[model samples]
Target chain A: MKKFISVLMSALIVGTSVFMLSGCGNGEKQQELNVFNWGEYISNGEDGTIDTIREFENRYNVKVNYTNYESNEEMYNLIKESNSSYDVIVPSDYMISKLIKEDMLEKINFDNVPNFANIMEKYKKTDFDPTGEYSVPYDWGVVALVYNKTMVKEKPKSFSVLWDKQYSGNILMFNNSRDAMAIAMRLKGINPTEITKKDIDVASAYLKEQKPLLKKYVMDQVFTEMEGDQAAMAPYYAGDVAVMMSNNENLDYMLPEEGSNWFMDSMCIPKTTQNKELAEKFINFMLEPEIGKANIEYLGYSTPNQKVYDLLDEDVKNNELNYPKEEYLKKCYTFSDLPQDVYDYMQEEFLKVQA
Target chain B: MKSKAPSIPYLIWMLLFTIIPLIMVIYYAFTDKSGNFTIQTFKDSLFYTDVFIRSLWIALVSTLLCLVLAYPLSYVMSRSSRRGQNILTMLIMLPMWMNFILRIYAWVLLLQNDGLIDLAVKFLGLDVPLLGNAGAVILGMVYNYLPFMILPIHAVMLKIDNSLIEASKDLGANKFNVFRKVVFPLSIPGIISGTTMVFVPTASTFLVAQYLGGTGDKMIGDVIENIFQRDKNVGSAISLVLMVIILLFIIVMNKFGDEEVVA
Candidate 1:
């Protein structure tokens, strides 16, 4: 009788151990989807507002593990190196092309995302995704001039202001190659995407000359630098311009007459993602008018969702930075992925300047 | 009598973490396609311009800064009362105990224009651009590694015989002469160890450079990081080249340093 009891007890212990291990394993896999996006670009849905992720969680019964990357290049490298199973990635237009060319992204199925119809008519069928097959537009904005009124005597409207000798040592330009090149290209009245040896040389010369004038080349943190009043002026994303203006009364956002770069950051699934269905659900959840509007309002970017735009507050809808006049739109250019060889050449030249 | 060798499990752990990674790096250094090994990978990275020279310069600067700032503080601590020494040592090491990334972030806040230091400058009516420059990167490197320098020098100083200093003084050596001839000579090992500790890590750390440095402040670590993280290169080749660079640096420094010791 005692031997029988010992065997029974051992069997029960084994059963419990198996049960615990299985429970932990399944729990980890069942409700988890990893999201990689820009930092501070999402709402956490606290303070009685519905965050997009919370909406996804409620409908899909999946927990979202959100992470942020500061730049598209950082995101691309990370996803390439590690077996990163990020279900969703947000990258800009040019980056999407790069990823697609490299076969890094999965061709998204729109059938799973019924809310794609809600996107603005213009945002659809962009050069980056000809068929609109791989990506869903998230937020779109222009990179425009943001300056401190208190520092400048005259209101600056042209990209020429960046090259002004008077503003030397007080001006801040974007440190990124693409953004900086875009500004220079527009000022020279050259096509940003078209690669000519002379065009690049001119841009390089312009940059070298501007180097002395610049306090520093900055990226996302340019806003903080501007807020600190270190830079009298900078070329920054329009959405960030609004945020800076709201906080500091001295700041003003301007749409440069020389044109600016128009960017659309989209959400796409990589081929490496293990959770395709869940990713589609989350993408669709983000497209919901309310969810999209909330993100745009909270993050202070222009929404790509037409439904969301109609729902925006009157002030936001009327903001010139968010919706500039049609003439300004004509001057703006959208960046396309350069030929790999051209990109390599540009990278070498950029390093040369540093060297 | 047979003594059982260390269990196979213990041997396996060391081989898995240390030996295998080293082997993989060496193997990948030679390979191409960002993954499978080839000789081209090694050649490409090796030929990459000024990677070795820039790394050496930065490391040397950081090491010199560590030595200058730490030696006096450590000496002072060694001369203090036991309780005071303990307190001072803790204070010096306190920053080290915090997360490395957090410490860097603090430097960012402190160095940025309109940061704490900048605000102080403004309050005093002075124009200053201490943040986002080469000066800030060097300052940060010294700040982070100062404790490493101090602790080693302090340990060596505490081990020092007090009678030696008394003997020097008895022979009519002044304070400066005593320090140069007696205390300094005795502290060579500590200096070398401290310099090595500070130099190696500061040279490899790109975070401070990325945050505080401007365009001109790009370091060897940043280049390696760009190749691995930005370019999405398999990084095996970069790793291999970096190892070679570091090995050559250490060897050259050791030869020069040993000669200095002998002279």
Candidate 2:
């Protein structure tokens, strides 16, 4: 009986392995497209909203194997290591540039995706993709200071309020190195994008000085802390501030006068993709007016799709918190991929400040 | 031979999951991004010695706190009847069945400014900053790991012979002396095992520190995590160093346990 059991277990293992291997091969009638995106960044048809993935599958007769990543670095590492599985990935501006530089991303075939024209004129042919060949802009937002109006007597006009000793232990800062350092750089009147070792040292010193004033270095916890009046102020994305403001009446958001990081997350096909055409098709489907509208409505982030912007509610369209004016946009700087040594140096300095 | 045949699968599992991954870590630790053999990774990790020391200090404090809290509680539970012991053990283990992150989040809600504890303190006219400090992180570590310390000691305590305790008493030893000479000595194995279980995880924990600690309270795990995302070589080096440190710690603990046994 034991021998029989052992034989059966071996057969089951072999059978499962064979099944898994076959599953990866193109044996099915419908072609499969693998999509990786940031967590909670998409609309999944909640509350009678349109399920974009389902609509695309129904329209194109292709299946989408969807997954979520928490950060750009994580997604980049996975794609860099083994790019064959994922056809499409959504990464931020800096990560997109890194992938392009590393030759990990494929140039988009505009002929297959005629809907590429739907992207706003401003988002096209930018620094990240100089010729507009590699990526399609998906969503964009700016960083802003979120504060409880009741806590502070005066409006915080500059980033220096984060250093104010009166509000010490009542302020929150970004947990990540890039965003945290960018704020300090802007505060010091240095261009955050074009940073040097000296600039990093200056910023790290500034952050260390501000450390005592900080309540915490936080990420998603910003929502709970800010909304519950646990913190007086925090630097966070404008889109998340909108969500928090909707929940708490006392909460307000402002773009710092010094400048802030304007980030864009874009969808691109990796070089190792087996389903490039299907991936482009999926991208085009996402760019469709109704799909774009549903996504923007759900996400609360600014839409790069002009048609989606036009179709948004009048209140949403006018909400400066969601879509800041051109003047604000002019002052905002998008992050560029730093050299590996500089990146490592910045990380080391950031840790030193924390230490 | 038949029994050895069954061991083949287990050996393969160890090779595939444990040994290979460890080899990969060691390989990456000693190599550069270009896959050339280099010790630069280890040299770079040396720059963050402060973080390593801070992580060790915090973990040491939390482990000590867990031991202090758990020893008394486990003793009381052990002294109870079988049914009472089972109930108490279940009570201790019940909170663990819930998600660890969720439980940490619950603590966040309870400890944040104007939170439950804050509100209670304010009602009595005493205000305190509860969240986002070293205290909060240590509290979180102790709360999470108290059960780990308790369970091993509890298991060992259950096996402790009552006849030994009675004989100590009958030999004209007082209650405290009996506990010191008999109960405490007998429970050394449990204490050692429990210390190892609590200390290792608490030392490596990044989440508790990230969620509860202030900006100044960065741990080695966070640094390792950050480097792993950016450069795997540096991360692997730091991880290898961490592994060696932990191994050294275990060896020291085992030596201490041996000394206690000899005494």
Candidate 3:
């Protein structure tokens, strides 16, 4: 145990110190574009899919320095705290809005990114970026309640099913405060947007009431539990649900008619970009139809680009679980950046529920 | 003066890495997010009393279990021939060589519903839920830290002068009195250190509970980790409190160990 803690500490120290160091080596005349994205977010030539970064590098005669962050907070901290220069980043909608509020994102010059017009109109003027100036939508997904059909005798159509006493010790819920509290807020008929302390108290009450029934407050572990048939039900992202179903034939999913949280991850250049035009060109390259299709298919998420949607495999394009219909999407809500105090209150109250 | 020169590099390393980070933790604990002085961070951490209690309880249980299991085994290993001691030492250390996360995940696979352990329980006509409980979390902590307990006690017992036990016997002490009056007292330092080693980490570490425990089994470490991502002030405050609790625990343990041996 001591060894594990020491290992974790040294690893975190090394990771942060290394991140703070600005490596300015681009070699002889090869312009470097630093692209920071979520891990496993892009296709990298495996299974005959396009190696998007390699293709970009080879085509433009530029070296693409790629790095990955697991969460928006980590990425935000790196950019805020370090001299590490990243030209491009893929942050989710609320995070993009936060960065925009902080004036950390650079506006994309649409002339350099002609393919911006290919993205669906709805994704362009999203709640997170009303003017669509700071970011271009890359992918979108909604929360889905996935269940092992063998364990759940009835098809679960509502979030209320998660609180059922019958499913005690078999239900997995989100471990993160935002998702967990948002879902709880929704179940209480309160809008998940513009959260308040009163709303948090109410949501936390519901979570506390249901804590006994939860197998675990899980993030990635939901995949193992649901696939292994150790859990009867779990609420997870639509993209990951598709991944889980592929692993376990006993699993199926529903969009929950009441409502669910929707998330959109968009690509944007930070305000600190060294080469703005190159960043914009790289973003445009990502929006290319074939590249977008391969990337979206490999990632198992719904693409915001119309050309990519049209180019998708017939079976993938038709999979409603991965791409919920527009009407069901109407009920889906996207989280915008909350007031800091309210956000902190929500986190504290969520911890209290677990406590 | 000679020690100071040899320790210069370590002292500098501690000042830069440990002391600075610790001071920052204190700074965060006493301040608000905007860098204003406040105790609100500590006040908010009060909401996590239940988690703190649970963490301490789990840690205590794990430590006691390690002591109970390790004491007799260490005693036997100390009494064994040198060859036997070597083999036993090797066996205790073998599992620690494997990746920590892998071992925890293996426990998850073995204890979850219809898992190997659960299957055997079912075959015995039992319907007990094996995973997602405090018992599972405690089991994980005990398994991971037992070797720490055994090795320390074993090392101390091996150092006991053979003449002491013989002297106690010569004084008309039987087997039980010789062990009680001689071998055990001499081994108290090892027991104290072993207890410290097992209990401190068990109380603080979070991942074991995450993998093996249910939602209700959350520890202070888990809460600290989750809250740290959002509010570093409150996280630091909670961490400060946990450290104080652990410090108090160690002080108490040392006092008790001294009293036991001195008596």
lDDT, model 3 = 0.91
Estimate the TM-score of every prediction: 0.82, 0.89, 0.93
Residue pairs with backbone atoms closer than 3 Å in model 1 (clashes): B30-B38, B31-B37, B31-B38, B32-B38
lDDT of 3 at A42: 94
Tens-digit per-residue lDDT, A269-295, candidate 3: 997789889999999999999999989
Q: Could you tell me the lDDT of residue A215 within candidate 2?
A: 83
User: What are the candidates' individual DockQ scores?
Assistant: 0.26, 0.50, 0.61
lDDT: the better of candidates 2 and 3: 3
Cα lDDT tens digits for candidate 2, B1-263: 24688789999999999999999999999999999999999998898898899899999999999989888888888889989998998989899999999988888888877788878988899887787788999999999989999999988887888899999899999999988999998899999999999999988888888888877788999888877876889899999999999999999999999999899
The model with the greatest lDDT is 3
The full ranking of all candidates by DockQ, starting with the best, is: 3, 2, 1
Q: DockQ winner among the candidates?
A: 3
Q: Which ranges in model 2 have alpha carbons more than 4 Å from their true place?
A: A1-28, B1-12, B35-40
lDDT of 1 by residue, A19-119 (tens): 98998987764568999999988877766667777677777777889999988877987899898789999999999988888888887888889999999
Model with the higher DockQ, candidate 2 or 3: 3
Instruction: Please write out the lDDT profile of model 2 over residues A230-261, one tens digit for every residue.
Output: 88999999889999999999998888887799
Model 3 chain A scores worst on lDDT over the 10 consecutive residues at: A19-28
